[model samples]
Each structure stands twice: as C-alpha cells, then as structure tokens.
Target: MGAALHLAHAGQPAPGERHRTKGKGGSGGETFADFARQVYGDQRATPLARELLLAFGYATMVAHSEAERDVHDVWSTARKAMGATRTGRRWRLDEAIADDAPRYVSSKDREHRVCEAPRLRPHPDGPDDFRNVRGICGSLADWEHYALEKQLGTGWYKYHWFCKRHLDHLARVREQLREPNERAPQPVPNRGGLLPAYFESDWLGTYRHRLDSPTWEPPVYGISADDWPTPGVEPVAPRARLRLAALDGTLLVEADRGARR
Candidate 1:
C-alpha cells in the first residue's frame, strides 16, 4: 500500500533523470540515492520503517509537487483528526473524531470495521489527554493496548474515554443518517486509518523521540507565588499582663496571668 501510494504520488521521473542507478565507491563517495538504498536495505530496519524511509525519500525528491502536497494533506488531516497538537492547546479529540468521522475499512471487503483509540504515548509521562490519542482499527488497537498495558497499566483510562466518546459519536451519526425524510449521509472513507501503522512503526524515529522526550507542557492554572506561604520571622507569643481598673468612688480591680497562663 505504501509503495502504491508512493508511486501514485511520485508520478514519473523528469526527462533525462535516472530512476535508479548504481553507486561508485571512491572519492566521489555515495550519492543521496545510494545512502537511501543502504538505509532501506539494512537488515535491521523493519518493513514499516523501510517503507517510511522510501516514502520520505520520494516525498523529498518530489518536494513542492502535487505528490508532496497529497502526502502533506494526508498527514495534516491525520494529525488534526487525532488531536496530535502541542500541549496547552485545548484537547479536542472527541470533537475532531466526530467532525472527521474516522473509520477503519477492511482491505479485503471494504466494509467499515470497529475502530479503537490508540495512544501515541503510553504513560507515566503522557497524560490521559487528547493529544496522545489516535484512532486505529480494533485489531491493532487491541494489540497495542495489550502490549502497553502489559508493560505499564497507566493511561488506559484515556484510551477508554476516547473509545467511549468515539463510539457514542458514531452512534449519533448513524442515527442521524437513519432519520426519516432525510437523505442518508454517504460514508466518508477512512484516511486516518493508515496513520495507525505510522504511529505503530514510530516511523523515522520521530514519534519515538516524541514519546521519550518531554516536549509537552501541560497548562498550569491558578498557580501563583501568592498562593504559597511566605517565610519570615517566627511570630511572637502574646504576653500575659496584670490589669487594674478604677470606677466610681475609687473602686479598683486587678487581673493577673493566673488561670490564663
């Protein structure tokens, strides 16, 4: 699928441009294509990673072309739909998913399938927030959720919330489509579904870096130094004293620290 997409976007090579060429070893060294081939051909690189590298190379070579624009559009749409924004932005995962109507269609049958909300970051660091959530097919979601949960049980609540919200939204959409005297809305084909593969692969190591590094700054509300206690000299205790009073005709009374002390 990635290769097909790449080819579709890449179109044809320009006049006199070589699509593939052998690299020569020596002072001239390796060409960019040679380096790309070496990276893609490395036995250590996963299939998904290799494909991502190839896609990236193709995109770069065809920069500013329609292919690049299409690729950018797809990624941009996925990012927006997944709420993959920098922290401090309002979490709008539910809103974005509802608006986008993301679905997973079976490659064999082309039927819509149940989708799951997968987290981009499995926590201690990642919060139960929209920024970490991405929509994926049920199988992939289950696998990812189980793997993460097995390793660390954190962040499940965020996944649960996202799934519930997404399901409810889908139900509402379905109901609306079934309403009498209303034309049923056409099913919007899934574009974001492929994004799960990218997320799962942690393609180009960028997502991995994002997960490992603490880039997100959660918003701090109502926090101020004024709310904290100030340090100063210790308060002095009140001293007891004797009091004397005179009223009418030289009447006098004296009070001491007796019982109070």
Candidate 2:
C-alpha cells in the first residue's frame, strides 16, 4: 500500500518498467514471497498485501490456485473494488441465473400485439347448465389409436402425458447408451492410512503376486515389506540396492549390491 504508493511517487522501478535498477519494486519474476519482500520489505505473503498493491495498479507475477477461483475473478474483483456495487447487494452466479414465470405478453411476429383470450365467456345456456369442457389435443388418427388402446391396451399411440414421460425415458436411454467404458477409480481404502492414488502404468505388477497369489503374510509389514515401512521401526541400510518396478521392462536391472549379497 504505502510501499506501492511510495514506489509510484518515487518513480521507482515499478513492475513493467524499462528501468535497470537492483532491489527495486517490480524488478522482475517475483513470486508471492518475492513480491511481498520487494513491496513491503517483509517476507509474509498476505492476501491483503497482494490486494493493496494490485489495487494500486500492478499486475501479479503469480497465478491464483484453483481452490480460490470460485469466489474470485477479475471481473468481480475490479467491480467491487471500484465501488460500482456499493449500495446494491452483490449477486453471485446463483442469484444472477434463475427461472421466471412464462411471458404472458409478447409481440406476435413483431407486427400484431395479441391480447390473451378471456378466461370466462357468457354462455347462451343457463350459467348453472354451463359445460366445464377441457382441451384434448389429438388428430383423427391419434383419436382412433387412443380409443382402440383404451378399449384393449393394444395400440401404439401416445397420450399427451406420454410425450414428457417418453422424452425423459429417451434422455435416460441416450445417457446410458453414450456412457464410456472407462470406470471411475475407487478408493484404495488406505489399509495403512495412506493416500489413495494410482499411476497409469504396470509397475503395480511387481506387488501383484504378493497381493493376489497365495503367500504367508508377514505380521509386521503385512504383505508389503517391499514398500511400506513398519510403524515405529527404522532401517539402517542405505537406499542404494532398492529396486523400483520398471514400467518399461526393456531396461536390464542391476545386480543386487554386494552389501546385500
């Protein structure tokens, strides 16, 4: 803040400058730590510190991590900082996007303005004897098929309700048909309280025999003395003779070292 302003006032080597001075503000290629030290004469990387310097018109050399992305973007940051939406409450993505009631008034072909039809019309017959008829949208063929199906459940016709139902069914069917064969990775269950992870290659084959084939289980290291170290135990040997399972089998492995031999 003060440092950024001081640099600006000093006409100091601000970032993106053509000057060639050492230990100056915005010299070049400063990470968050580097930038903090250069700007504030301190080594702490604070969000407030970054915001203050950037707000005073400076670009950061560092990229924001993916986790912080949802609540922060260039557009929102700039707008909120400039006091553009001070009085009005800020609308998030959810608030900005929404469903609304169907439009009752719209231009008909942009030429004629069509008003809605009256819901109630005067009946020539007595009001008590008036019909409460509802709409049925179907062609003669549809009517014939529907009537036949109604009689026997024997025809290939769709009721209006069937359109939406059948559409939903079709969407599900399409998704089922389009799904790829690739399976999602399951958790490794961390039998030893380790991260569940995977590599794409066949290095796992080295441990496969112990995991899958019949073997006497070791009590301390389970079935994997090849990898995991036992709890509260340490080995004195150097790591020189350790054999990593090769994904590429073409490379000839070195002999077990003389110490082990």
Candidate 3:
C-alpha cells in the first residue's frame, strides 16, 4: 500500500514546484514527467533509499495491473467479513472486531479463514518468516492456537489472518491500554489466548529508547474493545476521547504531548 501511494504521487511535481507549473505552457521549464524522471529515475543521482522506493513503486504498479483479480478477491472477501455491509455503521479498526464480536468471529470462520489473533507472534526471528508456509493470503486455521483451542473447548478461536503490519499495530494498541503497574500475563502452555510477553518485550524496547531520547514523551494509553468496561464488570473513566481521536486519524499524539507539557 505504501508502495502504491508512493507510485501514485511519483509523477507529480514537488509541493513547492506545483505552483510554478500550474499554468505553464508547452516547453515551460521542465515537464512533470521530466522532473519525475530526474527525481525518481536517475540512478547516479538518486540515493540508495530512494532507488529502492522507486523499485517498489514500479513493482506495485505492475502487481496491481497484473494481479488485479487476486487482489480484488482477497480484499473484497476480507472487507465483507469485517461487517462492511450497507448499514450506516462504520467499522473502527481501533476498536477491532467491532460491532457484534460473536458475529465477526463466526464470519471469520465461515467466510474468511485466517488468523486474527492479536496476541500471536507472526514472526519470532525477523521479516523473512513474516508469512507462514502459506502465502500472504493463506489461511492459518490449522495453526497451533486454533487446534489447541478446539480441543480445549473455549471462547471464540481466532481463525482470521492479518498482515504482520496490522498485527504490530494491534500490539502497540494493546500496550497503550496496559496499566503502568500491570503485570504481564503468563500464558499456559498450549493455551489458546494472547501471549503478552512477545508484545511486552517489543513495547519495552521502544519505551526504553524513548526514555533515552533527547525529546522524551510519555506513553499514550489508548483503549480498545477488550479494555472497555462492561456492565457489572469494572466501572472506569471511559477512554472515549482516545477512541474519538483515533477515529479522526490523529490518535491524540499532539494532544497528549501538549498535555504533558
């Protein structure tokens, strides 16, 4: 998606130059294509990072053009399963598996068979193992968690799959909701739920780095559906402000920074 975005805007002039070329006639300075080529095509002048970006951009364009059918099938299926029906209700990813939780799980099982387990580690070592033996869109229904959960007879087993990036995002959201004094939950061997250690370790590394940075910032505690207090559960000050911020695409980073100041 990032590659696609980069490619989408690669042909346009830079923000500063856009005004200059707005009304230019033929042969007016450098054409937009010429400028794009100079900025994105020149191997000798482009930095290694930029060259790699251009390569990705080209690859993205090619993939979209050639794999249109496969992309459509995968995304359409996932979208429909996520409760993207004609209803006026819009799904909030921050809430995750929003609306009817049971229905969402059922749809995942019946319609989309993938791993939506937020707590599972997609890759322990590195990016190479990002996707399991099954390709990117492959189902993880036969994974250990699912099999174990089936044998144990318990709550909804997550049989949906998400890309590594989204799994990382969910991990961060979970960390943000964690109380400062909270202790990490130890997972029982072969248990079918979240393993907190994997996410905690990653968050701790980032937290330590943030503490050592020149511009230190406090952690953002954004709540998710799991953190939401239920009736007769625990009564707590609702974190609706954080959810609203996430919906508006800000995530309250600036607001939190100002509050700290």
Candidate 4:
C-alpha cells in the first residue's frame, strides 16, 4: 500500500475529535486539538472565536514545507527585529519615538498621545515584515478594532490593523490586483464617426483603398499621398541590428557586410 493509504489505515482522529498532542509553542505543551476543544466547548465563545481558534490549531498541526519554512524564517527574523513576540504583544509607539519629536500627531486635537498599537500586518495576506505594519492612534485603533469584531461577529480580533483611510486604500489596491475577467467590464465609448473609413468601410472600399488612390484622403494633418513611401520600391537605409545577450552583452547582427544577404 502507498504511504498515504497506510497513514489512512492508521486511523487518525477527525478534525473535531478531542485529542492531545504537542502544541505549536514546543514539545510537551498544551496540545492544539485540546485547546481547540476547550474553545469550542466554552458557552461564552462566539462562532467566529471558535473558527479563529480552529484555524490556529489547523495551521499549527500542519507541517511546513521547505519553501514555507524559508518564508517563516524570514518573517520570524523581521518580527524579532521589531520586538514582536511569538504570542502577539502590544508595542508602544512612544518608545520608538524621540522625546523631542513624535512620528505621528493626532489629526483631531493635534495632541501627542502615546499610542499602544498592536504589532499587526496591514492585511490578512500582507507580508509579515515590519514595513507593512501600521501604528494608528490609540482611540482610532480601539474604535477600528471594535468595528472589525462587530463586522466579523466575533469578540476576538485578529492581529491585523488599519485605520479607515488605510483600510480603504488596501481595498482599492486589492481590487486593482484582481484578474481582468474578475473585474466588472468598463463601458466602451461609442465613436461612430471617429474611426477611419478603412476600419468601418465596406469590402469594396477596403480593397480599393490605397495611398495613391484618388478616392482615398488623408484623415489627419501633415499626411498626404506624396508623403507615403512606396513599399519595396524605395531604397531602404542600412540600419545596424543589435542583439542583446543574457549577460548584458550586445552583439551587432549586421557587423560583417559579406554576412548580409
């Protein structure tokens, strides 16, 4: 039997089944499965809360691939540099700012308040790097967090922060990144007379249309039958053709006169 079939025969517990195993923190800790059950079993736990707990459990239990591990390592390094913990900790903006100068001032009152912002990614799929994280004003952050919780139908808020403006900007950016087919089709302008006769003209007009033809006329200024160059009949200029190599080296294709046919 295949390894997958053998593992299947081994009889692993269902997702909702209560079982204890090593947690994400390390070995011998409270198991994710048990933790998930505890969260689900609680009467006070909301549906969103249960889902969030379950997602965390699922993420922890799944083994990371080599590429995933590499990404995780980079994210870990960035988090460490920003003084963030594995279990999310709130960071004070005042600590990073100088006593004389503040990075941000309140738009409402123009007061310098010490904002205790949670170290969070701007969006769910945003990079784990510190550059993507924003530290909004304290009152604004609290209101935003509350609004998010209400919208999600959960008491627990995920570690993703954005003020109204930032949130709207991210939404617009995401919309722009969506596939062309996924986006709503834009209305095409009706330009009945704007198009040239060659484009909208009948078969006879298209076939008979020529630069020197008496029936043909220049649609735009600075263009006429006398200005149109005759194809194959005119003496063409011998221009040097250049080819670029993979390593940034350029090769002149028409270097040798004898090589040219």
Which of the numbered candidates is closest to the native, going by highest lDDT?
A: 1
**How large is the C-alpha RMSD of every model relative to the true structure?**
32.0, 25.5, 21.4, 32.0
What are the per-residue Cα lDDT tens digits for candidate 4 across 1-261?
001000001112333432233553443134444444544553323354344334323332333211113323322332233453345553221111111110111122223222334434353435553334443333333243221111122112223333443555435544543453234232111111111110111212322231123354232211211112222333222221111111111111111121111
Better of 1 and 2 by lDDT: 1
TM-scores for all predictions: 0.19, 0.15, 0.15, 0.16
The total of clashing pairs for model 1 equals 0
The number of residue pairs in model 4 that clash at the backbone is 0
Sort order, lDDT high to low: 1, 3, 4, 2
Residue-pair clashes per candidate: 0, 0, 6, 0
Which parts of model 3 are misplaced by more than 4 Å?
A: 1-38, 41-46, 66-261
Which residue pairs come into collision in candidate 3? 114-159, 114-160, 114-161, 115-160, 115-161, 116-160
lDDT of 3 by residue, 141-170 (tens): 432223112212212232334444455544
TM-score of 3: 0.15
lDDT of each: 0.28, 0.24, 0.27, 0.27
Instruction: Write candidate 2's Cα lDDT for 1-261 as tens digits.
Output: 011111111122223333222354443333334434534542222344334334322221222112122212422342344342334664221111110100112111222211112225443444453231322211122111211011111111212221221345334533543332123122111131000011111223322331342332322322221233322334212212212122232111111221110
Look at candidate 4 and give me any clashing residue pairs: none
10 residues in a row with least lDDT, candidate 4: 1-10
Candidate with more favorable, higher lDDT: 3 or 4: 3
